[model samples]
Target: MIYSFKILQRYQLSKVILVVLLLIVLVVGAVPGYITGKWSWKNTPRITNFKDLRQIREEGLTISDLPTISHQKIRIADHNWLLQKVKQDNQSVILLLLTPNGPKDKPQVEWMDINGFNRWKTDSHQRVKFTVKIAGNGNGTTDSEKQSSNIEARFFRGWTNQQTYAVMQWYAWPGGGSPETGDWFWKDRSAMISKKRVPWVAVNILLPVEPLADIDPYLPQVKSIGEKIQASLMKEAFK
Candidate 1:
């Protein structure tokens, strides 16, 4: 009877030691992740029905109301893009909207680089490059929204086979705008730490410029139109 009692006590002590070891391991493993926010949970809401250009508009910009020259879906680098035109300030502007079509669709900024331009036969030759700043509404209820509201877009002057245009392009997200895919990667990593998910769309805007004219003269109009488009996308599609 005494031997049986000793055995039972040993079993109980072993169980208690095992439980303590497990708890220690759990704390050691979880504390660093928690401190670094590597284990943070973020909500990524899918943006839907964004293909309708009519639904996307800024206060002073008129979209798709003018005569449509070309409205079609063109494939580039294994991804499909919506190529359409909008009238801004009575000038026809070409807008290229690229969105993720499915779970497997991963969009990259390199898709629109020189080789991609060659594929489209645009014969694009990039010239002056600059950045446009879009002011935030300052009414964002969250930090991410506020930061994203005030973002910068990249613009450039480029020559196509037909004409010269002031082109502005960026990968826009609910959290902000990235001029390059690499910029988006770092922003996304930081956002993950902040427990935020940023889904993005590639936006390309082209405004016609007269040949032999200085591009500096056309920058104001490009900035105005670019700001409106970014703001409109944030207001409409992101919601």
Candidate 2:
């Protein structure tokens, strides 16, 4: 009888352990989905209107705090405003969130503005090229110096022409030298170009460090960021 009782007690303990394990799994699985669903339910702002967005920014609420409309976020502003396509005047903005192809722990949100919402509108592309000098040594001398010079650059978006005349350029400058601004080309989709739009602002971004010259060692991460930025811009445009 004693042996039988012991075996029964052991079976009970085993059953308890299984129950506990099952409970843990259920909790663990449910928590993330619940949180994600909650997050998805919030409203995010669409870029089609900026006066409303300006109000949201001035109101000082983060995007996550807003209510949702049809599962789309109504307040789309991100923390990296300068890097996240914050607009001024009539210029469109672009933000490159993360680049390294590896898992990004940071939240990624892509936004764009079309038409020179608040930027200098130029008719000719030739007049738009300007120098952008980075104030550091690019000699690749010391490891620290090299790292300092190795800028993982990201840009906010603006345009000189309408969305049809958007330009994308990359440049670099040594500490005390003239800025070596690279070629600037229209980045607008051909459809916009065919539409004859003026004061066009198409927000685009070269994700952090992807467009910088001499950037083989900084691949994967740098390239990934650039690709993400580009993808984000395209996604926003489509939306």
Report lDDT per candidate: 0.59, 0.29
Q: What TM-score, computed on C-alpha atoms, does each candidate reach?
A: 0.59, 0.21
Q: Where is the poorest 10-residue window by lDDT in model 1?
A: 56-65
Q: For residues 3-77, what per-residue lDDT tens digits would candidate 2 score against the true structure?
A: 999999999999999999766755654455466674211221122423332332233222221221211112223
Pairs clashing within candidate 1: none
lDDT value, candidate 2, whole model: 0.29
| Per-residue C-alpha lDDT of model 1 across residues 1-239, encoded as one tens digit per residue | 99999999999999999999766755664566778785432233333444432343221223323444556676666666667776765788887777665433434654455335633323233332333233456654554435345445665666646677777677777646766677666565555444444566777877888863456677777766666666666655664
lDDT: which candidate is best?
1
Candidate 2 segments exceeding 4 Å error: 1-81, 84-215
lDDT value, candidate 1, whole model? 0.59
- In each prediction, how many residue pairs overlap at the backbone (N, C-alpha, C within less than 3 A)? 0, 29
